[model samples]
Target: MTTKTEKVEASTKIRPRIGRWEVDDHNEVALLGTRCAACGEVAFPEHQICVNCGSESTEVVRIKGPATLRNYTIVHQLPPGYERPWVVGYGEFDGQLSVLAPIVAASRDELHEGLSLSLCVGVTKVDDDGEEMYSYQFTPTKA
Candidate 1:
């Protein structure tokens, strides 16, 4: 018997992003946003010009904890880009920021608008080569 090993590179799938997301060992996920110090408006992915007040002073911030499922839909058809056959949606957090993401509930019955939810980091799927594509999703919270 012989054992073989293979080294895999991740450049074939979705491009990796930086500085716009946060993940942990527990699989919680959320969009990283920035806040404008001069105008006090929150911006996703660190905006230099404040959209609301036109200010240039901003700082990085993370939107975590306590999000509500605002709306969702099951996507059967994938665009020329992106994944398919997934329930994708957006949620409004307790921090008054609305973030759109994939719905990772066990079933459709588990999703509803205004449902309390939690963020988690997750692997989208495994490729034919057994490579894992990681992404984020929101799950409904318990009563």
Candidate 2:
């Protein structure tokens, strides 16, 4: 039998499901993206080559938030391994960067176009190894 401390330790071992994101001690999430040196375009998940200019020159940059919700969909038909419904949306930041991420909301009525969202990290699922997998998600910013 596992002790209580062991369970806590295991729960704290979170692994990011995607690359280019970091979580602080407070659980605040910061997404890392790449900026094209040639075209000055920014992209998430950090690309090696610039998609806009076709240039290999790129630099890693942090994505600053307060993303404005553009659109969203509530998915009821889940894929294999998913247990419940979830919302996903596109949020535009800085009037240039648009990121598609899962949205965390208490109710469907709380979501709408132009809602301000902030980046956060949470456990999306557990892996076969019993490790918690975390992904970047957007939550409604507290007014």
Worst 10 residues of 2 by lDDT: 1-10
Residue clash pairs of candidate 2: none
Q: What lDDT would each prediction earn against the true structure?
A: 0.66, 0.77
The most accurate candidate by lDDT is 2
Q: What is the lDDT, from 0 to 100, of the residue 135 in candidate 2?
A: 70
lDDT for each residue of candidate 1 in 14-124, tens digit (9 for 90 to 100): 454422566555655556788889878886645778877988887778778568888888988864434567887778876656777677754777777778877765666
The TM-score measured for candidate 2 stands at 0.80
Query: What TM-score would every model get versus the actual structure?
Result: 0.71, 0.80
Clashing residue pair totals per candidate (backbone < 3 A): 4, 0
The Cα error of candidate 2 at residue 28, in Å, is 3.4
| Candidate 1 local lDDT, residue 111 | 78
For all the candidates, what are their Cα RMSDs to the real structure?
7.2, 6.6
